[model samples]
Target: MKIENAVIITNKTRLESLIERFNTKAQAKFYIEHSGGNFSDYEQEHFVFKTSLSAVVEKLSVHFKCKVIDRSYLPNYIFTEKDLPVVLGQDGLVANTAKYVNGLPIFAINPDDSRYDGILLPHNINNFEDQITRIVHDRFVYDDITMAKATLNDGQTLLAFNDFFIGPASHISARYNIKIGNENENQSSSGIIVSTGAGSTGWLSSVCNQVSRMSETETEIDMDWDEDQLFFVVREPFESKHSKANIVSGYIDDAHPLIVESFMPQKGVIFSDGIEKDYLNFNSGAIVKIGLADSKAHIIV
Candidate 1:
């Protein structure tokens, strides 16, 4: 079998959280126990992740050239075409990493299945060897996942495996000019959420849930995981003399993209997949166009 290089992406465990709060494991244990925080649960969770990681590393090393990396470094880290990413986390982490990975085949591995309902994670510690063997031999199936992209007038672009949040950085109201298809409106609200198929069941679903609750009639929309189109929902559009709320929610595709012009003078921001730290400025004079990206996530199945 031709060996392909593999990148194992793992995140920090709860032990890091314990260390962060108390500065040491002993102090963390003391703090947790004294506060009735169940230190044993933390210990068990940490042990399980460490064991799974050891197994993954040991197995992959025998098959291909592999390296382990932390989740925090995924943004700055570069991925090659021949590199297969083995993401060891929950469904959200898959989505987070997918945005930067381009079209590389991602082997999603759930470190602890009992703790997570990983919709995107198909492999675990026990069954990962078989999956890795197949991947090395070029025998596997993958799901094509379409993602959303947002381009600013300044030439900066943001990609979302799940969705994009465009709004104010602070608690104040956000002002923007929204264009959906041919209709355009000046909207004043909280923000706008543009979603892809991967995000339809996530942030997009919450918006739909709220809509269902507010309306008297029942509403249902079929959202398939590999769907080509995208969805956008404007949050809390206020009706006034200058701002309109008619074109608040709609669909976007190759033919029609969601466009927005920022009216905010300061603190306006645009970020993808709920990662707030990585974002672009969307203050006044910024025009952002959100649509489907040419890149897709190839998840090993």
Candidate 2:
């Protein structure tokens, strides 16, 4: 692809969030100190992130037209095919950006290596320029990470780089008719989590850990980041006179998708990548098909 513009995706730092909440930096600092929290940690984090971001912008602007957008505007922002996305923040930021970038190659940077684990960010401030040079020459390498897709019968769809949550919007049990292949049943549970290969180590792994501990046995929970299939687990399936827990978990592929018909009167939703604000209503009369998506997240390695 001929990349001519660089779109930088960013998220609000802790300090910025605090300031927004308290209406001023001084008030934010006072509130944190009153709550026995260390305000300096927030300040330090903000400084490091700004420094790194400035350097990234300077480098990208040398060759390509640059534009920056916050994480909140991702759903409404229109991205063109000739744009390269430069993600500079935590690993979750990268996951959040991938869903809306339309499979564009991402140059992920770790602003603070000491504070963030940065599993998705392979580029640091010092070495990112070399990768930029490669990008300028159209010689950069990338890895294709698999993604999960949730499609509603009404034609609305949501894509996830990590996983998808299908259930109620509240603390009550979710009611739905779940079908995988020929096996199908009505289930009442906390919710259902469908995990992509890149997301197996996240919420999916925690569920696996709990099950393994309860069963007192070892279980394999994670898969390759680029695996074609997806794993799903129904959380806390409750057996009742109206619901059955026979189909609690399974793998979803191209041929056999996990289909769910909602029986909830209200408050049911389906959201991806833990962003509950951006979701599809899944109340009664809604049927959703969960499967592997055709688009892959192309991250520069």
Candidate 3:
């Protein structure tokens, strides 16, 4: 599509390398999200370097022959909904930032793939020049992946790109009162996971013991959940004092009345899109609903 104007958003270390590689044509900016006392690795201590991100922005502006704007200038650029520019960030920041910016397509760059999962990332920064050129020149295609929606008991609704999980916050077992349309399932188990087609490969696979493929059709609203049907996996039922770990698998019609009971008292949390959204209380007739959302995520291949 011939990107005459673009913005470069990245973490500190990768910014230097990205600027040295990509030749900017028109307008480009570098944004650095402040990381304070946060360690990249769990074993290492958190430390901030002496060089600020602004230095990298200035250097990149000169090197790439583009205008380098700071994070403060983002609001000015984001004047209208259509003014949403292509953003580049690490895999971790892509989905969340895209959601915040009202569903902008984030081109995730995998700086180091060995340490973490880079499944969503397009390519490593080593091929930054070629990949960016291809993206700008309309040489690649992007897909809009469907997202899942959940409504809590308190009438709070949220959207998730990956999966929505309802489970115990602590290590103890928990219960969930679940209802899918008219079919009711009272699950007394560790938790429940309502996953999207995109999240079929992750935790849902481990729980259901089956790999899930991405949905080909846009907004496939099939409620039929068999071995082949998509939108499944309600697992790790709560074990009562007299009961065992009851793990059930079935379609929407086969999902029976679910009620989870745990001896250990703990708060159960609901996660939207792999992020902790809210907490649910074990009360009389507390209902948790799971379904597909109308929104979707645009993905570039």
Best by TM-score: 2
The predicted structure with the larger TM-score, 1 or 2, is 2
Models sorted by lDDT, best on top: 2, 1, 3
lDDT of 2 at 121: 97
Give the backbone clash total of model 2.
0
Per-residue lDDT of candidate 1, residues 1-301 (tens digit): 3546778898778887779888999999999899988998999999998898888888888877889998889989898877888898788889888877877889999999999887899888778889976887789999999898899998999889888999999988899999977799898999999888878888878888888899955655556667888988889899999998998788899899999999999999999888898799999999999998987888999
List lDDT for all candidates, in order: 0.87, 0.93, 0.47
Query: Which runs of model 1 end up more than 4 angstroms from their true locations?
Result: 1-3
Residue-by-residue lDDT tens digits, candidate 2, 160-183: 999999999999999999999999
Q: What tens digits encode model 3's per-residue C-alpha lDDT throughout 1-301?
A: 2334345444334333333454431111222213342223321211221122243334334423334333334434452233223334445445444444445555555545454476766655455445454554567666666665555556766565666666777676555445444544445666666655666666666664432323333322333111222254555455566444434543321233222332334476666556553334534444555555545666555
Residue 299 lDDT in model 2? 94
Candidate 3 — worst ten consecutive residues by lDDT sum?
43-52
Off by over 4 Å in 2: none
- Arrange candidates, best TM-score first: 2, 1, 3
Q: List the residue pairs that clash in candidate 2.
A: none
